[model samples]
Target: MGIKNRLTVMSFLQFFVWGAWLITVGNYWFGTKGWSGAEFGAVFSTLGIASIIMPALTGIIADRWINAEKLYGILHILSGLAIFYIPQVDNPTLFYWVIFLAMMFYMPTISLSNSVAYNILKNNNFDVVKVFPPIRVWGTIGFIAAMWMTNLSGNKASVNMFYISGFASLVLGIYSFTLPKCPAQKSVVKNASWTEKLGLDAFKLFGTYKMALFFIFSMFLGGALQLTNMYGDTYLSDFANTPKYADSFVSKYSTIIMSISQISETLFILAIPFFLKRFGIKQVMLISMLAWVLRFGLFAYGNPGDGLWMIIMSCVVYGMAFDFFNISGSLFIETTTDFRIRSSAQGLFMMMSNGFGAFFGGIFSGIVIDKFFTHDGVRDWHNIWLSFAGYALIIAIAFAVLFKHKHYAEDVATVTH
Candidate 1:
């Protein structure tokens, strides 16, 4: 296989492991397991916790010691094993710990995969901005395929979805060792603080003006990102509560409907290079923030009947809402930072966005939903979605006002060669 093709396989399996369970797990948790909303929120918080603690640490390991590809393989193997053991846990609290452990192993691999792909692509004289997205789109396809597999096979709410995730993860873990080497870049640690010595200097990104604002907004948008993942599928399925929609195709196939978001991702992922090159990262991201507003607003008013298009439209908008920030943000970090700290920098981005963003988003959203949205054992999902839409809008306006980055063609040109 070509190097890009090889990286593409890695990307495909990388997210496939995540997709098999991520969107559907809410269904499994709330529907099959009958867990409380508050507890389920804690369950999602595991993603944030592990992301906060592990990514930068693992990036440091990859930066200073192990090969990025090797480190990635080891982590995936661990994630596979840990996730495979999840079906055996009976208590929600124990389930939380187990998921936390699995995520600690799993989450770091996400950033590591980007690092490995970037390393291999750059080494082979590929233009990263032009080349990476096409390969990355396969990751979304892998995610879509996995979701369909789980849903079509009647496994969306079953323990088997985890099995599906675990098995793909293990295979990818084994496959990773064969990829091109991405060696530790820092030759020596010297003349620096403890954070620098420990390869944590990426944390210093917050000290700068533009990057600080950028990351802050990224964190806020990251919160919006999970709002859908945590509830999109569950929301569609919940229409069953309305007798008129009880036997509707949506309730029967909510997972499939939700997969449209990932499918939308494929096209949007391809468009990112054009968007980034034309509009620059700041405007592109601002557009993404606005898309999030539409994403939630549509969902707030969407239903299984006449409003079905609104629901479908929400999923469509999800494509731009998701890809604009994540891919562009990572690429922006790639072009601007010192290459020695590449992996660490990516980890830091993940920390701010997925770490702090996800942690607080999960915990607080759950509490708010339980306290305000849930009434008499039923959730007011319509208002719940509108509240989320309002939050995204606030962030969009703030980002437009405060964050500043002029799009010079040369800014992105750094990696284009």
Candidate 2:
């Protein structure tokens, strides 16, 4: 196979491992295991805890010591082993630790995969900017395929989903070893400061008003990011409790229905360049925040019956809510930061959005749901979604008021193209 095809397969399996279990894990937790929301929230927070330091640490190892591909392969294998062990544990606290270890192995590979791909592409004389996106899109397709596999095989809420993910992860881990080598770069400056050497210079951006506000909001919005991922499938599957909707398509195929969100993500990615050029970063991001409000509000009122449209629309809106802020925020950081600190700044962006953001979102939302949304062990999804919508709305209004960006059409046009 060609290098691009190899990378495409790698990308596909990378997300497939995640997609198999991510959306449906809630079903296994709430539906199969009958876990408490607060404990489950801690479960999701493992991603946040791992993201806080693992990616950067692994990046350093890949940069200085090991080949990126080798590191990536090893991580996946370890993560797969951890995931395979998940079904054996019945304790929620032990489950959290196991998943945390799995995340620690898995999360860093996300960035490492890109590093390996970019290194191979550049070495092979390909135009990375032009070629990478097309290959990366396959990852989304892989995710959708996994979701379908989980739902259709009657394993959406079963331990089998973990087996599917674990086996795929192991396969990908082994396949990664055959990919082109991405050796570490040993070009570090001898006179570099400790902060620079450690990739901690990005933290200094917190000293500036604009960047401080941006990172703060990134964390706040990041909290909103996984709310749906943590609960959407569970919410849809819960509809089975209703006699009329028990056999309905939406309830029966909740994972597939939720896959529409990933599909929408691919479409919205295509729209970003146009949206950025026309609306500027701030406006585009504001549009994303508003889209989040609608995303949740629609879910609040949606069901598998006549209200199915609202559910589907919510999935459609997710494209904008997710892509706009994430992609646009990266662009904003890229265009604005100093050349020397550019890479670190981007890492900082991910740290805020995925690290602190995921942590806050996972932990608090779980507690809040358990405390306020649960009644007699049943969840009030309507009020739950409404509360989430209200949270996003507040973030939008605050962003509109506090984020001071003067959007010049010429500036955006120049930067985008």
Candidate 3:
């Protein structure tokens, strides 16, 4: 295979491992096990905890000692074994530890994949900026494909989904061993202070008021990103309880409907360069926040009967809502931070958004739904969505006022390369 094709395959399997279980685990927790909301929240919090620590440790290993590709393979193989074992654990506590181990091995591979791909591409004289996005889009497609397979096979909540993901991970793990070599880059490196080595210098950027405000808002907006992932599939599957809409297409094919968001993501990612050039980072992110408000509000009013379009539209807007913040935020960090601490800055970004943000969203949403939205042994999903919509609106308005940026001509020229 061509180098690009090889990278594309690697990217696809990376996310395929995640999509198989992420969207539908709630069904298994709440519907199958009849677990409490607090327990489920604790289950999901593993993702945040894993994201905070694993990536840095793996990066350090890849930089100093091991070949990146070999480490990547080892991690995936261990992760596959961990995932395979998930079906055997019945208790929440044991389940947490198993998945935590799986995440420890799996989470680091995300960045390692990027590093490996970038190193290989640059070696082959390819442009990382222009070529990487198209390859990464396939990862989203892989995620969508996995979701569809789980839903269609009626295995969304079944332990078999883990088996399937494990099998795929095993295949990917073995395949990774055959990829181009990515040797350690310790020859030109020098010893440094602990803070410098750990990328702690990025923390100094926070002393500047503007960067501090931007990261603060970035953390809040990250909270919004997880809201849908935690509940989107469960919400659609809940429609099966309604007699009138029980047989509707969405309830039957909830994963396929949810896949539209990922499909839309592919297109929006390509459009990002244009939007960033035309509107600047501040405006692009503002547009993303407003799109998020619409994403949730439409869900509040949407139904299987007359409002199905609203549900679909919400999925469509998800592209803008997600890519606008995530991709742009990464670009913002890239442009603003010093090169030496850039990796750590990116880690901090993921820490705020995916780590703390997702942790709070899972726990907070669970409490709110349990306290206010559940009654008579049924969840009032409509009102629950409306409340979420209101929260998004408030965040959008606050973001608009507090985040100040000017679209100077130089802003367009800065990232043109």
TM-score top scorer: 1
Q: What order do you get sorting by lDDT, best first?
A: 1, 2, 3
Per-residue lDDT tens digits of candidate 3, residues 89-206?
9888898899888977887777677767766877788755567678878888889989999998999889988998999899899999999998765443367667655545666777
State in Å the error of residue 101, model 3: 2.5
TM-score to native of every candidate shown: 0.98, 0.90, 0.90
Question: Which of 1 and 2 is ahead in lDDT?
Answer: 1
lDDT of 1 by residue, 137-225 (tens): 99999999999999999999999999999999999999999999999976765677787778877878889999888888878888887
Among these predicted structures, which one has the highest lDDT?
1
Q: On residues 295-385, what C-alpha lDDT tens digit does candidate 2 reach at each position? A: 9999999998889999999999998899898767866775676544544465567767877889889999999999999999889999999
Local lDDT at 215 for model 2:
88
lDDT of 3 at 314: 94
Q: Going through the candidates in order, what is the number of backbone clashes in each?
A: 0, 0, 0
Q: How far is candidate 2 from the true structure (C-alpha RMSD, Å)?
A: 2.7
